[model samples]
Target chain A: MATPYHLKIVTPERTVFDGPVTYIIVRSTEGEIGILAHHMQIITPLVPHIITVYPEAGNVEQFTIGGGFLEVGNDTTVVLADSAERASEIDVARAQLARQRALETIAQAKPDIDLIRAKRALQRAENRLKLAGHSAGGMTSA
Target chain B: MAAGGLKEVDRRIKSVKNTQQITRAMKMVAAAKLRKAELRAKKARDYFEQIQAVTRRAVSKGGAQKLVAPRTVQRKGFVIITSARGLAGPYNANVLRQAVAKMQEVGGKNAAAFAIGRKGRDYLAHRNIPILQEFLGVGDDPTLHQAQAIAREILQQYLGGEVDEVWLTYTKFINPLTHEVRTLRVLPVEEPPAEESGAERSYVFEPDPETVFNDLLPRYVEVVIFSALLESKASEHGARMTAMDSASKNADELIRQMILMRNRLRQAAITREIAELVSGAEALE
Candidate 1:
């Protein structure tokens, strides 16, 4: 069995998870990376992506995080996200509604509407939907 | 006449009792809100510390020098955070007073403000200070999105050369009963002190140091603003809680005094009536 390391996922709102984990896989801005116990120290900005954590053998948990930073120190690995939600905690109906609203707003493209914000909203909604096992409505073309 | 005086005291006691009820209710609400705000502030502080540490480490490694380098102060921008409503004792007044004092120190015409609450906006406006923007109704709980928007505006002004220096003024929460107003510079990010830079490990910055450093600068500012918002929120709630608690106590004291006076008046009236009756009976005999 791989050695366990202390891992914590923190957001501005609260700490999402704090425990010992054997492994964690996250998509940093550089690319997909995985960390094990006693890894070299590194700091990287993360995009909005799913973070996969393995607390023990055959046990896997996933969380969707809004863009933030990841720091691997000697004793602890911390993920600082603006927002994060465990797969089980995501509200599927709310994600769907948010996605629908974002799409409608983009379609209308009003002068006063902030397109970048709408797109980011759509992206977050899709990420949540994907984590919740929804198909994301196949709207990737937008 | 004694009866009339007694009735007047009763009416006053009732009014004071009514006022006490309202103050008690307000205290309870403020207490509940303060609890939530305190919890959020505690959590956000962890994130803030971590981010600050990392940013300091990066800066010590000679990253994002341009952003960190200080410039000549021409125009100054103040982001003053207060509350929307009053009744929070001196919560708003204390912060505004300090902010205005700092602005005067920075020179009146060279300073402008970005007001984060209605109270701040009104105070600045009443003083005839130029306000660049006003954000109202942030409510008791501030969200990260609001912080991001405020950060964006501050950065735009700084980078666009509209302002040379940017500062944040808000109340810091020490505890429910204790808080103090603080003003700190936010722009041209301050470098970490040289003494603490020792024994720092060199970490690999992803996608090259420049890109990561550039990205982290704005984010660092955003987190600072966010943490400030949380601190100010907790302080505001704490101030309101203490203020309301004292108000309720005052009402309690007033009611007690009035009740005591009414009882004394009642006894005096009874004593007088009995004495009159006894003297009349004696005279008839």
Candidate 2:
């Protein structure tokens, strides 16, 4: 059996998770990468998505991550995430509101506004809503 | 004479009580500020991690920049950080002491000081310490702009060759009860080791490396300063809480002692009155 590896998920806000995790999944700017114990050392930029960690055989820790960076080295996977939130902690309703706001910002197409940032926000909030789930969705009429 | 003695004691008690109230209030304020400061400190982690990743790759991987370059060991510049507004205990004293010690250890052409808080400014100024810049009224919430202003000044001095390095000294909050005073070198760009030996990742600078670094380094410094401000904020609160707790305890002891003295004085006055009355009654008989 491979040796257990250390995994640390850090955000600007706090150290979200730090312990021995069995395996890890990451969404880099390029693509998704699965890292296990003794993975080759690599550094890459992170994209906005869900990152899952298997702490035990069945127990999992999932997070909605924003753009940042990740480093895998010496059986340690340190994810320096721009922002990350656990699935259980997210407020589904508020996330939906944020998603809608981001989408609206993207649609307005203001000449000076940072469209990229808005679009990224929309995606991030949408992902959170997807995980969190809420009553308010696609009902433009309501 | 008895009345006069009683009044004097009462005044002392009241003054101590008033000071105790102020200390108690300050402690509460520091605690509230600490919570917010800790949150802000937590928020800035991701940005620094990004820098760390790049550093790891740049220094570990093959890079043109060497340790000996001006980017690494420019060992002298100002450290700008904040201290708490009001005094509860040794919060400002610790910072001043720690900063002085660090500078002393460096032991060469002394770095100038850029003070942020009222406490640090007053202490440093009174000692005739050379101050590069003084910023006050940072208030509770410090903005990136404030940091930018300070960073700009420090960067100018560094680029102008007035100082070869810049360092920042501040108290970093470890927890609610404890804070560690730390000194971090901010200027002269430092990079980390590469991802793997012989892994050459080419980074194309938009305008130029020099141009980008000039902008990036200052922004980086500002971010660092902003973080330090938050850390100091939290530390200040922690220190105040401890200080206030002790002050309140002292006040309680002082109050207890004063009450004892007052009671004894009243008892002695009563005794004297009774004795005088008895002597007069005997003389009349």
Candidate 3:
């Protein structure tokens, strides 16, 4: 078994998670990247996506995160997300409502409403919806 | 001297009581906000502390040397963060005072400002200081996007040579009862001294260290500004809560004094009426 690495997920509001994890799969700007023990030290930016964490003994954990930076160095990986929420903590109904609102906002494209911001909001809400829905149905679709 | 009428004293007491209720409510609201703000400020510091680690490593590796090269500062930009409303007591004044003093030292005409709160914008405008940008309605909870927008403007100005240097001023939240105004030199990003010389570890750059540093520097600036905004928000709430608490207490004291005076005046009026009644009875006899 591979040794566990320290993984910390921090947001502006609080530290969402911090513990030793055997592996982590995060969606980066480049693409979805997985890190294990002894992964190369590199820094990358992340997109709004789901982060899957495999702890040593407990069941796998998942989180929905917004854009931010990730640094892997010295066997420690730190994820400073703009915002983050655990999969269990996400509200499906609220996420759906937000996604619908974002779509409406982008469709309107009013000068006051930024199209990029609305699109990002939709992406974040969709990420949360997916993460929240995945556990309900036992399908482990990547 | 004629003692005040009972009706007037009653009216004054009623008005004071009404004001006291308002202040008490305000204190409660501010206390609730302060709790949330303090929590957020502490969390924001965690992000800042993590970035500091990244920045320190990058700086030690000479990643930010190009960005931090000193240049002659002919013009300076001040990013002043205060509160949108005035009920925060001296919170806005303390931050604005330091910013204005710095601006005056650098010459008002040569100084430009990016005001984060309505109070800062209005204060700087009245002082004849040119405001490059004004962000209003950010309220007690400022978002990362708001911080990014403000940082982008300051970065653009600094990079465009419009401003040779930038300074960020805000109230730093020390505790619920104490806060201090602080100013940080933001532009021409200074390379922080590495904590340990031999503790550096080799970091593999996926896309070259310089490119990562380039992307990281702007984000670092955003994080700094965001954290400062969070601290200022906490401080503002703290100040408002303290101010409102004192105001409510003062009102309580005023009401007590007024009630005592009103009772004394009422006693004197009753005494005079009793004496007049006795004299009338005697006259009839």
Top candidate by TM-score = 1
Give stretches of model 3 more than 4 Å off.
A27-33, A91-129, A134-142, B1-5, B62-68, B104-109, B196-199, B270-285
Off by over 4 Å in 2: A1-5, A19-25, A34-38, A52-56, A59-61, A104-113, A134-142, B18-77, B100-116, B121-164, B173-179, B189-231, B278-285
Put down candidate 2 lDDT per residue, B1-285, tens digits, no spaces: 987888888889899899889878877877887788778876765556545444435343433432214643334655746564666478777788888777767725465677888888888789887887788887777766677687788777777666777778888888877888888776555555333433344443323444434434454566677778778777777887888888888898999999899888888888988999999999999
- The alpha-carbon RMSD over the true interface for every model, in angstroms, is 1.2, 6.7, 1.6
TM-score for candidate 2, residues paired by index: 0.70
lDDT at A142, model 3: 17
Candidate 3 lDDT tens digits, B161-217: 888888889988999789999987876666556554245566665466676667677
Tens digit per residue, CA lDDT, model 1, B74-169: 899999999999999989999998999999987467899999999999989998999988888888889888888989988888888888888999
Candidate 2 global CA lDDT score: 0.71
Model 2 chain B poorest ten-residue lDDT run: B59-68
**Which residue pairs come into collision in candidate 1?**
none
* Complex DockQ, candidate 2: 0.14
> Each candidate: what lDDT?
0.86, 0.71, 0.82
Each prediction's number of clashing residue pairs:
0, 19, 0
- Provide TM-scores for the models: 0.87, 0.70, 0.82
What docking class should model 1 receive?
A: medium
